[model samples]
Target: MKFVTFSHKKAGHHHHAGVLDGEQVACLTEAGLAASVLEIVQGAKSALDKIRGGLTQAPRYALADVTLEAPIRPGKVLCSGINYKGHAEENPNAKMPTEPFFFAKLPSSVVGPDVPVEKPVRSEQMDYEVEFTAVIGKPLHKASEFDVMAAIFGYTLLNDISARDVQFKDSQITIGKNFAGFAPIGPCIVTADELTRPDDVALKTRLNGKLLQNGSTSDWLFSLPRLISFLSHYVPLEPGDLVSTGTPAGVGAFQKPQIFMKAGDVVEIEAAGIGVLRTPIVAG
Candidate 1:
């Protein structure tokens, strides 16, 4: 099932979860089932089933009538660094780590679909990383592969926007990655059971309609289960936590001529089964 959190201009900017159908949404709030997407996610499998049930009688709104928000403001936004094999190979000079190295993004950095991401003035090199983000459905601590897989609620599309100069120059990558609207996630979240082969999902990155990145989860050096298991080994992952499974090989930083984002550029990330996430780049 595809779940969304959206708001309409006529109703203001707060977001609420809903079941997305053809072009309309059956909202959980209007149906009196849940308060927010996070609440549903925290409820785990039962919450999803409730939304599905509500769809039969919930008030319907055109999907185009509302603004989509990032599925949830995850309690912790964890990310894997260069976990894709080709992505690792692309940066030949920087030796790739064997284990799952990670980074974090603050909640403030997230933006929903259609919102504009600023091209921060502090950096000359702004790049895009199309990521497949896993949303945790159940709390986990030192979980195994089977347990980690069970904990996954679904996956969504995310553009891991980066200010490269700030990243390389700073001791920690947070500042570079946490600029306002740096992360654009969601059109909808595709539940884990919806996909027949989650491991072989396709993903891509496009800049102004030009396809720049095309790869699949099949090429990932560290698969989703491994990422969750590894992270759970060190930190307690709660329901509603978001884990971005790194990007493919085509980020602009490693390109021969080095292309960077500029104001007016439109970025798009498409992950099969999951929806596309688009964001406009504007000057900060």
Candidate 2:
């Protein structure tokens, strides 16, 4: 099922978790289920099954009437770097990581679909990384592949809006990738069972209607199970902790002449199973 968090103008900015059926949104609350997406996720499978059943008879609204938020309000956003072979080849300066290399984004950095991703005036080299992000459902530590597979809640798209200058200049990338609106993720989260192989999904990134990056999880340097198991070894896998599989090659920074995003540009990250994550760019 495709689960989402949305808000309508009539309800103000306060968001409600619901399921998107075609162009309609079935609000979970209408069926007596909890309205908070985060709360539902933390409750795990039993909670989701209830929500799924509720969706069948829930009151629905046109999707356009409500604004979409990041599918879940995650506690931490952990990302992999240069995990795609093509992306790693594009940057000859950095070595291909032998193990999962991760970074974190603060929870506040998140925004919803169609939101404006502000380009801070302080940096003129902001870039984008379209990733296949996974949400953890069950807690785990040093988990096995079987364990990791069962722990996955679902998959979604995340545009890891990056500030290239700071990312390359500073040794640490967390800050450069943590700018407000830098982590725009959602439309909806397709539960793991809905997809046959999350690691084999196709992904594409378009900027202002021009396709820039296109690749599939089949090209991943490290698989999803390895990423989750690696992360679980250090941190307990919580229900809402987001773990994003890294982007493919076509990042603007590695091009003949860098192609960073500018004001008034529109960016879309689309993936199979999950839908598009549309974000507009504007000056800070």
Candidate 3:
């Protein structure tokens, strides 16, 4: 089942639920059949079954009439750096860590599909990083590869928008990636069961209709399971925690004549199985 969080036109409130028939959404409300995305995710199988069984009698709203929000309210945003071989090679100066290199992005950085990515005026080099993000379904601590596999809830598209100038200006990447609208995630979350092999999905990025990045998960130096296991050892991953698996090469910084986003540009990130995450670039 495809799950989503969206805002209704009349109420202007964010709601979560299973998408029905591409045209309608089954809103989850405490007073009604469903209450929250967390509740549905914790009991996905049963929630899906309930949605399917209630289809004939369920009340749903037209998809076009509502605004979509980030599918999950992530407790933390864990990002991997230089996990892609080509991306690491593009920045030869970057010291590739022996183990998975990770960082945290504040949850406030998240915005949903169709939202505008504000290009900070202070930085002239705004770039895009296409990544596949996995949502954790269960709490995990010191998890093994097997535990990591079982903990995954689903996959989603994430555009890790960065401010190149700000990123390299400082020793750390925190400022570059922590801008107000730096992270654009989701059209909706695709269940893990739908993906035959989550680790093998292809990811691509486009800027204003031009394809810029194309790579597969197979190119990852530290696989998802390994990253998950490694992170679990340091901190407990709770339900709705997001882990962005990293981006491939072809970022603006790597280009021969580096190109950055300008006002009115559209950036799109797509991952196989998971849908496209498209956002417009607007001046801050």
Alpha carbon lDDT at 206, candidate 2: 93
1-284 per-residue lDDT for model 1 (tens digits): 78888887644565777777889987787788888878888887788777777678887888878878887877888989978889989996657778898999888888888899889888889999989889899989999987888888888887889888898884549898888988888988888888757679899999999999999988888878889999998989998889999898999999988989999999999998887889999988
Q: State the lDDT of candidate 2 residue by residue for 28-115, as single tens digits.
A: 8656786787787788888987876666788788987888877788988898887999999999797988999988878899988998
On residues 232-284, what C-alpha lDDT tens digit does candidate 3 reach at each position?
99989988889999999899888888878999999998987777888999989
Q: Rank the candidates by TM-score, best first.
A: 2, 1, 3
Model 3 root-mean-square deviation: 2.0
Give me the candidate number with maximum lDDT: 2
Q: Is candidate 1 or candidate 2 better by TM-score?
A: 2
Candidate 3 regions with alpha-carbon error over 4 angstroms: 10-14, 44-49
Colliding residue pairs in candidate 2: none
Report the Cα lDDT for candidate 2.
Answer: 0.86
Give every collision pair in model 3: none
Model 2 residue-pair collision total: 0
Global lDDT scores for all candidate models: 0.85, 0.86, 0.82
Candidate with the larger TM-score of 1 and 3: 1
Candidate that scores best on TM-score: 2
